[model samples]
Target: MSTSIRVIEAVKSVNVQGSPAHWANEQGTRFKNPWTSWREHDWRDMYYILFKHNRLTPKAPENMSTLLPTRKPTWNHEGDDAQKLKATWIGHASFFVELPARANTEGRVPKRGARILFDPIFSTHCAPIKLAGTARITPPACALEELPEVDAVVISHNHYDHLDRPTLTKLAALPRKPHFFAPLGNLAQLMSVGVPQDNCHVLDWWQSRRVEVDIPSQDGSDKTVPAVFDLTCTPNQHGEGRTPMDRMGYPKSLWASWVAREVLPDLSSTSPKTVYFAGDTGYRAVLDEQNEDEGPVCEAFKQIGEKFGPIDLALLPIGAYAPRRFMSTVHCSPKDSALVFKDIKAKRAIAMHWGAFILTTEPIMEPPKKLKEACEEVGIEEGAFICTDIGQTMLYD
Candidate 1:
């Protein structure tokens, strides 16, 4: 196998070592709370400080996934064509996006448009425990064979749930290997899966790439669809790894959100439509920061908005946050999602990260329930925030 590598931006390179690190060691274990020395008022004091105004009512009960009506997985290539955007949720963070094909003259249904998948995790399990722990409550909406032809795959980080080696290996075997885009230090993992070195694009925090797309037009001729998609390595506060022995923690692989923009053929407008894939993130006051002091996270989001202002659609995570003491620092709660919505100023937002995988002790249904209440509290209109179950598809005009 040829071992050629291509460097795209300032992102650092990483080793593909397979040794396990100190993941759950008792002495350095970070799961246990530090309340052993706290007093009575200390508890209330902290509570009021954190959740002073927006108090969460009715603590989530155990077994949350069962609360919501279950929905079966469905897959199809059917869709209406009108230069619109369509998204099919494939459980967890995976999605099938059908971008508009050039106006077909025959009026036949739009043929295959660019099919882009986000954080495509096709593994049977997305947790460290495998058969022992964090088993997936629901299988991936569509198996790899059930998937439509893929043009590109975007991976956010190297977490087990985000980047599954077995899944990627299967995808690499497809007739046409899809283009893989990931943050720094992740190319090694993709190489191990047999993804062609040239097919991989390693990006930094503010870098982008322009891809040429062929959109079949209705006039019997092919239209040169030049979609300038800029895939920057936006910042996220999280860690990565699959096992205790191989804990490739945060800053090692560079967790990030992806911004894909479609610049019109005319040079007058740089980017007409922008879609943000807000990968896993925890709530931080800087998320609401109006200034740059919010650090890498705020700067990255702002840069995306400036380059491609007014995001058309945002796929944001709104689940797996429980035992707030630990998750709050890394994951965003429903209320925090509201804040992110306002911060990014997205036109519409779809919620994910819940009801699919058992990543946390929080009830599976709690995220959406809490999200609904949070939207209500902030007076967000209905349909502004969509929390659909697996196998649901959304159309954006």
Candidate 2:
């Protein structure tokens, strides 16, 4: 039986042990949460919720897309500016980021900065089936076809919501397939969708890899340099599995958050830029209704801050946490996300994981409003953490 919140498993804090550290500790085939101190409900408890508890369906506003309109992004793919960074929301946890151009290679090639897609699911539904499932409540900011050539696609986990096969299939067929990265045991998931094994990279926690993509030339010429960057698989508090049977059976796969840092040739003080994607994570179990912070909180965020303090930009989840008892294990509430904003020492943050779908009982508009209150409560600076429209693009200098 899993340890109850009343009892302490006393999960010890872990430091970065550069990889070769396999996390398949659960009988050498299954993975477990390293940061979560306790899970309030187990399978049996959830069985009760499924059959006995009332599942409140949320009501979305009639003008959801109108209120949070998607704007077609006008991207500068020239890759000329070495100091410009751009981020565009593609709904949910999906985002497109352009790291500054590879240093000192401005005129030699059409080096459109290292472009990355984070947890991109451009399909109309985020599920295993096409006809039914959590249909996209808001249209993608732009079609997947409209995206610029990408260098890497960073995945948080294998959850259907995060790793849509249809999207992956289309991406793999691109003229220049983007390198795909995810946590351990997920290589097969990518492969199932026809991504060549050579194009896939799955890592254990703290494992890092440097990926480079050849930039297109200005005159469509042959001579072009590559944009380089390092992507690190980081730990977080979350569970995995797509179907009910898979959830019941544990010898399952791994889940994670990710860190991406540019590798510029010029080793100047401002050469490297770092971006953190929380993907999906919970700060605490929220066991204490009177005081959520007093519960056993995940410590991984603090470690990430120590390793990569002052992140340039962080895309964090800020919704789908209505009934805290169950959702708090894998999803973060708006208040919980506010704590994450500080824990990672983010320079700036854009809220995600909401507005794209109505997955929980919380009113559709509550996440952003509550996030504002939480930020103010925690003394977070004004504008430090803000919510953007589903397809809005924000540029960083």
Candidate 3:
């Protein structure tokens, strides 16, 4: 089938309706955050957070420059023979993940397992204009040129920090041209940067698309089997805007968390390895007035856990949540991130979206510390919630 036909079929398989325009219609919007009501931050609140909040300024460590370059860990493209799951934190919200391909017995140089990249931002600054905006306090864990060939690239939103233009341009130029999956209405942005239309796939909340990959057998057998990777765009409590002037177009595009699973044809009956990537979120209405867990956001997570748990791993944001009064609607504090970790019932989770940029007033190192405290109070094990160094790659079984 043609690429356009395949996309249409994919949308139909998800049972989504309405035009792309209708997806963002305020009058009949389908997206809703049931737990917390969204209130826009006015100029006064912005001013207060920007100027009045003395604590918001990031205090770089005395040894920051010396320590930034020392965190590098050797990247292992090949995963452990037993677990077959490897993930490298490429700093901030970006990750390079490899899921084991089908066990190959005939050995055709077992094709490198499925390589997936999430929210890749390799530029010095995460903004529309390269010369201005939030500069990276720490360098990228891995350079874009050093990245292994990718099979797929997943973008959560149009925010400059998450969906950077320079990064996309580089990816578009790659010889392999990995498939790009983004939320509804983001295809325009991708195409604007020269990504081919056929290479982009758009998804609405709760919608799923399946991609097929081939891997050589492990035993030197020439035989191969197709591994199916399913990508689903799930709900998140956040807004989308690449710039302040584009606030009106927020709903026109969608923001989301994602869930990915690897299913081998031979092992179809068995459980698959599942990973949850929480692009960005806030935990406002998750708990109600009575402190009961009845909000839509909470319910959505419960539903996610019910349908996709127990998740093997989750990459959750744990920073940029200072001045709660102003950021409560858009960002999740470390405590909030811990709550989400529990809400989704993940087997393991790694903290992300912090340490590389001073997007808010909180100290750069505060997130991991707060996350550990919250996890302890809630009875989560110590190593269960991990904070890896910028260039560290952890093997997850």
Candidate 4:
């Protein structure tokens, strides 16, 4: 810890007695939304926007490179202060996170802590047919081949924007393929993308796995030693499906937020540093279930906070929420994101799911701007929640 670095008072997490059973039913045929009875909008709803509220679609920013600035990842892969954790925003809900490494580091190549990737989708377009899909407006942090050895890869859900088959296939083909994790009912999809069944983890909410990876020995020996990390599938308010059949009120597959915790020498103890990813979610039922803007906030985040409070860092969505009456049921507005940061009790947070693809009607730069307003409205400390350049790497102690 650096003397100059200030942090919020640590909030101890209260233990949760049992796994939340509201996530997926025993039959697994359908998933439930415990918070609200959501009414799914059909193509007919689009007519409402077209005929009644025809707002011109926002254009991509001309100075995107400057407005949504970026820099090549600058942290040394191996010698980076192990006590300092690094997060690289890989554009739009995609991030590469390295847990705090063991005190000492040793390697010719960059070797950070157990490296983990979240919702990595590097395609030019986020759709089944690339040519006719939403094109990526900003470039990814780095080329897929340039990423270092990854220990684990977690997908927030099966949305085309979050889960790209080609990208996963390429990663799975790497010599040192990573362990792939997703919410329940996604094992077959991961395998279809070349992830070995032995390396894929499809978990229900609250389920956790202790995965181990090899890191170069601190003794400077060419040999390596094993390090462990815990990957937990936590609850989120979202839905998943790729095709028409996969959708119809109930979720066809589970979607989840993830929590990654570092394992210290004493594996029995809890992690000193934890990271939470709110893949994609709506904080409350609005527009769809409630006509009013204010609604009952989802209890999932509070439960998540109870189990993993005082989170070191959190990546939350602050984009794609436009036509609040329509999109508020699925995506989070910047204000909603601010509440999520509070609900999770994160020490620090970075804004994502914006400045990349134009998934909705908001202006390209609107999310970050709105987030600033939201944070101020909520009296969050300045710099506590920030937006980094698309490819920038932020370090925290």
Candidate 5:
């Protein structure tokens, strides 16, 4: 046997034991219950449906044009900016947030806010091609080495896209490994990939831990800077998985969205501007459970608004949903995203999870366009939803 084939077999063998049970029991890795239930049809069944409907556009594995590399960004800190926040889209589900420069205000400059990452997928493909049956259409927008510094990383669920092994490996090996956060059962996945325990922080739904971020004052200001900021783990309607067969139970690891805000000294009536990061949620009936438990999604938002006040910026998913019958329950389409925006009462939001990886049946450029039109129809300002190309960064002052 060839040496390369032998190596490939060895790697596959190691992972096989840890593969999800659903795939193990079925012996067919191509189908999943969640995917099937959402579609009301199996993978093969969908193929036939598409063929019959004349929607099959089977193209060769040629490189997709839009999947080109974007240029690195420049961070220019001019004048006295008040703790600026800038976000760079580093491809699918990955972003880099730049904390403002720490300047002395009171007596000392607050520790510049810690950098945080979300459901990061730095690898080329989400799932193994042998399992998913397709490779990623686009490469990651930025390589790990290119990242400035990450202080914390949040794992939304156990999906390969959200919990990529290669990405975790690279992240774990950083000179100063950032604090890793995940749901309950996910520690196993991270350990399996070689991340250490001291660096990991796991949380259940609605749980929060305060992390200190140094508050900066104007460079020449004589004021003493604050000492920290806080990050909270909120809830989301999503699922988790490592293998096809592993039914550790959906939402087992406590799938969640996140809220990050400045920590006020008083912690009294002074409300800090909130930033919500929606991590791949489908609208669930439980969303409204917070109030009288009526309108799930809307109610969830109402509580969030009351607690966090008007959101200054929200990072929400706006793609990967297609063939509505299968995706609506688990993923929100562009229109559904707009509704979520209204529910949350966020001042502005950015559309993500699109144009990075081709994980569904929708065409590449459909998400942003649809979101824009939907926002317009709803009488929202076009600028309310910011959609930029991969690697582009936007500042919310």
Candidate 6:
């Protein structure tokens, strides 16, 4: 078989080295987390912190119903309406997004728009096994059966919390199988779960692909128009692995943020909407022994903002960052997410990866609370950074 390699930002080339190997920088070093040292002492310290400082228990019972209203999502399958964009939070890092197609006045119904799912996890537990893993503290916003037919699914990495096999298996069996997009080393995992190889699209940081969907006119006419969107695998400061069967596999099946932008056929028109999905990341300086002044995490976001930003909506993580010494290198706090929102120049931002799981020491609601304070401190408008209920759908025109 041919080897798989990708060059990111024209600076790093990562090679997939099979099950035992992970994607690495040009110099063959695995991706490194800023402010984190994975030495033996660091491992011991993390365990000590996890046991002593972390609050693994939820404040309330997990069976409690969500306060957010749950609704049957209405999906525009064709590219019939150009003005509509809707997103629903399923819990944690999962989001159901609907992108509108160009409006067709001649058809009786709007054309089928594109439906995209990001980091979907519908399993009862976000762990390796249902009986011996981290059980969800709250129920999913919508049942799998309630989900609309999806056109594509984007995975951020191969961590058990983000890449639940049960959910992927269920998705694979759907009548209308959605294409799966993942980082370089993830295709094998998806294929192992029975997802057809043809449906998988693997990319590396800065790599992009264009997807075209057909939209029908509203008047029930036979006319169909095509809507194209670009999906880019962007960078995030995180690591990946499902278990310790092999080495830590930190950079295996690379972790990433994703950017989706509409590609209008007309060159003269203003750029279409752009959405930034920060799968999971930390806001910290990338410590370089050689160059202490270089902040990899901060610089990556700034570069993203400069390249493909003025983002319309930014979905950012705002939890799992307690006892900063341990989690800060992998997860972002509410304040950190606020900085990311600013860095990306997002018009509006939503807080996710909290309220659904008790993964850290902070109270369940602390992220939203801190997010509000952070945004206010940064002079962001009152409603600029919002948190929705698990099942709530936010529409942007």
Best by TM-score: 2
Alpha-carbon runs more than 4 Å astray in model 2: 1-28, 43-48, 52-54, 77-82, 105-110, 130-133, 217-222, 249-251, 266-269, 288-290
Predicted model with the maximum lDDT: 4
CA lDDT of each prediction against the hidden true structure: 0.62, 0.77, 0.73, 0.78, 0.61, 0.71
Q: Write the per-residue lDDT of candidate 4 for residues 172-230, one digit (tens) a residue.
A: 99876778889988988999988888788787777788776666655665665555567
lDDT (C-alpha) at residue 123 in model 5: 73
lDDT of 2: 0.77
TM-score of each: 0.74, 0.89, 0.85, 0.88, 0.75, 0.83
Q: Per-residue CA lDDT of candidate 6, range 273-370, in tens?
A: 88899998877732214342234344567757877778988899999886565676678888888888988888888888986666777766678889
The order by descending lDDT is: 4, 2, 3, 6, 1, 5
lDDT per residue (tens digit) for residues 74-171 in model 3: 55454454346678888889988877654533323345567789999998988766552377878888679988677789999888889989999999
Q: Which regions in candidate 6 have their CA more than 4 angstroms from the true location?
A: 1-30, 33-41, 53-57, 61-82, 104-110, 131-133, 246-250, 267-270, 285-297
Better of 1 and 4 by TM-score: 4
The per-prediction CA RMSD against the true structure, in angstroms, equals 9.5, 8.0, 4.6, 6.2, 11.1, 6.6
Candidate 3: list runs displaced more than 4 Å: 1-37, 42-44, 49-55, 65-70, 77-79, 104-109, 130-133, 216-224, 266-270, 285-298
Predicted structure 5, TM vs. truth: 0.75
Q: What lDDT tens digits, residue by residue, belong to model 1 across residues 284-356?
A: 4232223422332323344455555587888888886655544555567787777567667678888877766
**Local error of candidate 5 at 291, Å?**
26
**Where's the lowest-lDDT run of ten residues in candidate 3?**
1-10
Per-model clash counts, in order, read 8, 0, 13, 2, 21, 21
Superposed Cα deviation of residue 352, candidate 3 (Å): 0.3
